[model samples]
Target: MSQSIHTETSLPIEREVQAAIQGQRALAAYLATRFETQRIQIFDERNEAHQIELPTSALRLLVDILAELADGNAVRVVPVHAELTTQEAADLLNVSRPHLVKLLEAGELPFHRTGKHRRVRFADLMHYKGERDRSSEQALAELARQAQELGMGYE
Candidate 1:
């Protein structure tokens, strides 16, 4: 499923929501201890109960999501194979659309064209982002090293 990046998806910090999320997080943490799968019961407003089995991995993911929500952080789950428009990719990378297009044109990032529009795979975008972040860190380290060598008082 495709989602437009323009929509607001941030978590709300309302007290009631926070309380409910905290309770759910505690329950998820309890369920995460099960080895193979977890059997949980859900009760409706009418007191009707339904039982379901969830894999331990899925339970663990739920625990993580709930924890983030409890901490008032926005969370998104993007499939690795999903294709994103340039604007969406740019938003994810915290860059402008024109800059992302330039990267695509320069072959710094891979993209596929459908008609006249370019699409980037989520996995490829993440790979490029990781490399860019690592390169930036190395550059910062080198600059610090040079300043120290010159006795620029960076230490």
Candidate 2:
């Protein structure tokens, strides 16, 4: 699998599509609650009908993706073990490519060189992101505590 599986750009969902997604999402969630797997029929452009079976987990994932689309958020599904280029990882982190490189060099995030190009595993990046987020939260909590102790008008 390649990281290029993601959409190149986020596009606005049309009203009709959004409405259909909402309806389908509701039905999928309902089915997920009642069954371990679902049989779905799909129609092609030629009006030919095809049926397939999907697990409850897939239905739940579909519901979540639909929910994000409904909320106008771009969603990218990256496999945990997938390798990402520096630019792709940077985009996921919402940071610049140079910043991501800095993190890789500083060992804040781990990456392996692929013929002079760096590749970061999606799982490692996510782990690093989680740790960074927790550290930030802790630092903010400490700052709040200090402010309260000093009577800095911060509750």
Candidate 3:
């Protein structure tokens, strides 16, 4: 069995939606700053209140996720420590299972075998994806530069 865990949450509440729609700009401004707040308070339907404290970095990430949800974007939250099977990792990377297996076999991506199955860490997959994206961007930029130099007039 795979150790990966994925959670999908619904969009913000009505009040939150209204706030996001009306105050998106202000929200963006607030997020741009290094606001220092240690805890967040939640009020229940019974009018009871509770507080949860989090570190500054965690709060920042929470705010970022909330901002994205407020903007009507769906978000997937994956823990850094999660481990995914080959198929799950392949799906996340938008590649074929066979290709991912080949990558694993070639030692391009680090993985550990469980019996006959291979497991890849979510963090490692993300790191490899980032590097791959950066490399692709650089190659595209170089191609554009070459086209410009050759007066290809393809723009």
Candidate 4:
């Protein structure tokens, strides 16, 4: 559900916004028919959705989102970052800037110093994620095996 606007013609922007939110083919058709205005700038729903007037090229994006929603597809944006600043990297790793600097200092992981600041590669973050996932999987497997041996649940 999203709030709509009628800043342009006072015809009924809310109705159009409602159509977009519903994400049905009929709704999409209604929107296309109603708002002859072009260019809709859509942003990630993480914080807030701000509206901006876009050119006709943005129609493709609108169509994609509507189609995805209509097909019951989860609309999510994966931040496929290839590189990040020291602060961003620290945030990703859930570590403080100082601690990350310590890792860089200790030569534990490879990092590039950009002038006075440092940057971490996304590959390193991916590697760390894989290692953590493997550890979690191993722990879960062990727990399941232990439960089975102890006859914890009914067969």
Clashing residue pair totals per candidate (backbone < 3 A)? 0, 0, 0, 1
TM-score of decoy 3: 0.74
Q: Please provide TM-scores, in order, for all candidate models, with all chains considered together.
A: 0.74, 0.79, 0.74, 0.41
Candidate 2 segments exceeding 4 Å error: 1-9, 24-28, 31-35, 46-49
Q: Model 4 scores what on Cα lDDT?
A: 0.65
Ten-residue region with minimum lDDT total, candidate 4? 3-12
Return the top candidate by lDDT: 1
**For model 2, what is the error of residue 67's alpha carbon versus the real structure, in angstroms, after optimal superposition?**
2.1
Residues 15-99, model 4: lDDT tens digits? 5555655655543563554454654446786866678665443455667665655554445322455667878778767889898
Candidate with more favorable, higher TM-score: 1 or 3: 1
Ranking by lDDT: 1, 2, 3, 4
Residue lDDT tens for model 3, 1-155? 65536565676777776666555554444444465646567799998999976566765576676677678766677778889999989998999999999999999999998898899999999999999999999999999999999999957
Q: Tens digits of per-residue lDDT for model 2 on 53-125?
A: 9897877777777776777677777779899999999998999999999999998898999999999999999
After superposition on all C-alphas, the RMSD of every candidate to the true structure, in Å, is 4.1, 3.2, 4.4, 12.1
lDDT of each: 0.86, 0.84, 0.80, 0.65
Considering only N, C-alpha and C atoms within 3 Å, which residue pairs clash in candidate 2? none
Candidate number with the higher lDDT (3 or 4): 3
